[model samples]
Target: MFLFYQRSVHTWFFLCNFSSRKWWNEETVAVVTGGNKGIGFGVCKQFSIAGLRVVLTARDADRGQEAHQKLKHEGFQNISFHQLDVTDAASRTSFAPWLLREHGGFNILVNNAAINGVAIDEVYSKENNISLKDFLVCIS
Candidate 1:
C-alpha cells in the first residue's frame, strides 16, 4: 500500500510505500530528487530494476543525463531524467506541471537528497563531545 501526503494548495504530493513487493505494475511510478548520485542514485537504480517507471531528478542537467545513461547502459531501461533542485522555487514550480502531465501522479518518492555536515568516522570518534544541536543539524 502507499501513503500520500498532500501539502497545502495541492501543488505537489509526496507518496511513500512500506510494502515489500518488488514491482506493483504500471499503476506505480516514482520521482526521486537528487538521484544522480549517492543514496538517491541507488534507490533509482533499484526501483528501475524492479520494473517501475522511475523519474530521477538532479540539479545538473548534464549530470542527470549522464546518470540516466549509466543506468541504461547497466540495463535499467525504465529510468529517465529531469532537472530539479529541491531548494529552488523555480525548479519546483516547473516540476509540478510536468509531473502531473507526464506521470499523472507519483506512487513513490525517495527523499534521499541530503547534505552531510560531518564525517561519520569523526562523529564516532568524539560521540560524547558532539552537541545535540550539532547532531541534529548534521542529520538535517
Candidate 2:
C-alpha cells in the first residue's frame, strides 16, 4: 500500500510498501527548484547521497553556487548548480534548451520553488508570539 500525507502547504510525507527494486543510477538526473536553502536544500542533499545526479537550482545565482560549493566541499560529486526562476516565463523557456543541451534532459523534477503569499501583521504576531494559524484564528 502507498500512503501519502499532506503535512503542510509546502510539505508532503510519502510512505510506500512495494517490491524493492533499483530504478535509477548515477545518470539519473534530478532538478530541484529553490534548492539553495531549507527543505529544497535537504532534498538536494538526500538525492546526492542516493547517488543520483542532482541539479540544484535557485533563483539567485550566488546563493545557488554557494549551495553547490558547500555540497561539493562535503564530497558530493554528482551535483551541479543552475539558476532557475520558476515565476519567470523567459527564464523557464531558456532553461529547457540549456538543460537538454548540457545534460540530455532530466528524469525527475521537484517543483519546490515558492513564496509565502500571506500578508502577516508583524506587530501583532511579535507581541502575541503566535504561529500563523493562531494569528489567523485570533484575527478572524
What are the RMSDs of all candidates, in order?
12.7, 10.9
lDDT of each: 0.76, 0.80
Off by over 4 Å in 2: 1-17, 116-140
TM-score per model over all chains? 0.64, 0.70
Put down candidate 1 lDDT per residue, 1-140, tens digits, no spaces: 33233456432222446667544775578899889986678778767756689999998889999999999999998887889877567998998899888889798887766534465456655775667668888999
Give the worst 10-residue stretch by lDDT in candidate 2: 115-124
The lDDT of model 2 is: 0.80
TM-score of 2: 0.70
lDDT of 2 by residue, 41-103 (tens): 877877777678999999988999999999899998889988998766788898899899878
Model 2 residue 35 distance off true place after TM-score fit, in angstroms: 0.5
